[model samples]
Target: MIHCARTDKGMVRTNNEDAFYLPEGEDKPLLFIVADGMGGHKSGEIASRMAVEEISSHINHSFLVRGSGNETMQIIKEAFYNANIKIYRTSLQREECSGMGTTATMALFKDGRVYIGHVGDSRAYILRDGCIRQLTRDHSLVWQLLEEGRLTLEEVRCHPMKNVITRALGVDENVDVDLVEHEYKKGDIFLLCSDGLTNMLEDKEIRDIILGAESVGAAADKLIEAANSCGGFDNITVEIILVD
Candidate 1:
């Protein structure tokens, strides 16, 4: 496995609310996480950091104890659920972070399989052969509109409420998480990123950069650079995992 990750505050945001986790070594499979926090006065940063740390710790301790297939999915779900509960409780204790929330996108690579747990609008994508496919759907109002056929891709781009996510961690006592798993093939490139990068570049643009890059590190850097080039209205973070 080859992997690399990058995060930038971009040009607009004074502070980077994005937080990510990429664990090292082989004690367990690679655990890649990306969180895009929402709130003011640095609350967003704290929310994302807490979610990543909580989820990473749970998965590190419990991953090997669980069986594969449905059991693995359950373990992953529980990890995120615990993270949500922790964040929500913390938010309740603080006035500044009262409604703090964040998007969580996690990817686990293990034994020829790929599992994804997603919430809010952060995304996971797989590039196999030359085609790019989004693995997780956005839990945003605009995404719901798109699903209902009430909005087009072009319309979503211009929609004022495109950033209004319908679901997020820490906002409520519980969150509905989307979990998925599939057999991974050699040469498959998996990407997990915050909406900052997605909002700045289209899927085709991301595909082109990944295909043109020489290494996973280069691909991640190029993606961040591209987003910054396009005004970089928000914090940007991306993780690239290549199955070798």
Candidate 2:
């Protein structure tokens, strides 16, 4: 079984605003996703919910992502693009949702490999042989500054504009996403999480937990707990997968 767990908190706000879920079924294979929404009004709920529902609907028996077909990167791009359009159009049709946007990170498991599609800062990580690697690049200004050598890693994390994302769904009609593919292995585990969790826990800390935990649920709980200990100033969301 590929274990998955999720939880969200309001943090300093009045509502538990963040949303995430695992696309469940015994169909082709397992696909999991996490979305973090941003909005000035109550549209945060609408944007994240729209993203999850659209992606889930698009993946159900519509595409044959198995065997040799599983390696096709173009299929992954189109599916994500459709989801972006679905949410963007929905936002355009409403007033409260006008300024809404969300960060999304999702993985599709088929055959013996996994394909990841991501936008904004929500991230995907693969853990194998007790090593953890970040699989998605953050589309944010701080990330751009880091890449340009204008800011150090330590400085970038705490920058005032660190939360400002450069790209997201529902903000524009066209979106640029990062597609990542990795072959599978026995005892491999994958984690999808929002920035709230990463903001408090360092990469090495995540590696240690994924390595030491007895099960995927335990590992996810430990990660969220670690973030809460540091401050929990924002909502935290996580999904863990163990491939066997």
TM-score of 1: 0.98
Best by TM-score: 1
- Go through the candidates in order and give each one's C-alpha lDDT: 0.92, 0.80
**Tens digit of per-residue lDDT, candidate 1, span 1-244:** 8899999999899999999999767776579999999998799999999999989888888887346678778888999999999899989999888889999999988778888999999999999989999999999999999999999988997799999999999999988989999789899999999999999999999999999999999999999999999999999999999988
How displaced is residue 226 in candidate 1, in Å? 0.8
Q: Local error of candidate 2 at 16, Å?
A: 3.0
Supply the TM-score for candidate 2.
0.93
lDDT of 2 by residue, 89-199 (tens): 878888777888888888887767788889999889988877888999999999999999999999988899999999998888999878888888778888899898888
Pairs in clash, predicted candidate 2: none
Give stretches of model 1 more than 4 Å off: none
Q: Pick the candidate with the highest lDDT.
A: 1
**Hey, what RMSD does candidate 1 come out at?**
1.0
